[model samples]
Target: MDSSVSSLIRTSYLEQPSAEQAVHPSVYSKRKRLIDIAGALVGLGITAILTVPIAIAMQFDSPGPIFYSQVRCGLRGKPFRIWKFRSMVVDADQKKHLVRNQAQGHIFKNENDPRITRVGRFLRRTSLDELPQFWNVLMGEMSLVGTRPPTPDEVQKYDSHHFERLKVKPGMTGEWQAKGRSNVKDFEDIVRMDIDYQRQWSILYDLYLIFRTIAVVFAGQGAY
Candidate 1:
């Protein structure tokens, strides 16, 4: 039908380059190096001024590294180290498989995960633990706002449709984080939202999500 042809044309047009292409590079195709540098510097400064004390407390609360780093899938399936303030025991990864899966989508979070340490519990509930990801943002491995990064295993499990998420840089906070986070209990719904982000990505949308994230962080709502 003519309507079907029009729909196809619209989809094709969206897939092509647009005016935003020169200023804002494709998330996977080009590196927005400036964003990485400036955002990271500011983030690092804020983290040092505000989060270092908390990091010190986390170290004292447990006998392990102050920070935790894990290999996460980045743009175009590239692997990058995602940093976070350590909120679990040294053996957390080894014990993860033993715990019941409580996450929605490819994520593996739990509302009452036993692996969380006392300080970790607070950090997670308050989202302070994720402050370290500003470094990832600085390192060009992530963005301040984008789709949540997936693990290698999760990426491997993804269907072809899920690969679209890699078209943009991963983010420290995203639609998922701002919307429901742990409250979203269905994996398919998570994928749907991620796809929706790609279809609707805009600077305004990112800004709106960022403000919403601030509210969510302040309220500490639905976060484990």
Candidate 2:
């Protein structure tokens, strides 16, 4: 983790949970981990191939680091640094106040955010910026198919019911990403879909979501 993200880190000592506290079956399934590992290996391979070209475009478009890392709360409110190909001005975080957030509830977003660089816009629209997250999946902090990770600030706003979304590991794509990501502006809807995923989850369902995500990506639908 970078020095900037280190300060926001929340490392905790987790204890064995009681039967009632158990999460979804997918959370601890060995088959799921194997799938995650296989998918991450392929994703990282793509990331590796694109790294050089993406870095060049970023530097040419705006002078800054090639990658961006930020603290995000994972399963059970544990914090980890989420990585992405830099898609904004180097000081975008510092200039956050200059931009107005259009999304409602806990998250922040702007369709026309001025902080995004020219190359960054393309990366985000293509979902290429998320390629690096495969590493998070491989490291066991995330999954190939699951809920979206919440930022520390976002998690702080979560009530008891809201915390249910975090019961599963965050994913590269899930219900929202596969279906309504582009048009779903409300956070509550995301929460509902997340809980629904947990209820309807199965290995086959995960594979379906993964395929749907690929189609969504190719169609260039959804994503800020």
| Candidate with best TM-score | 2
lDDT of 2: 0.85
lDDT of 2 by residue, 1-224 (tens): 34444333332212323432456678889999999999999999999999999999888999889999998878776788899999999999999999998888887879999999999999998999999999999999999999989887776566557777777999999999999875787899889999999999999999999999999989999876
Tell me the whole-model lDDT of each prediction, alpha carbons only.
Answer: 0.74, 0.85
Model 1 agreement with the true structure over 96-205: per-residue lDDT tens digits = 98888876667786777788899998888888888899988876788888888877767656665666676678888787889987788776777777767777777667
The residue pairs in collision within model 2 are 182-222
Error of 2 at 16 (Å): 15
Summed over model 2, clashes come to 1
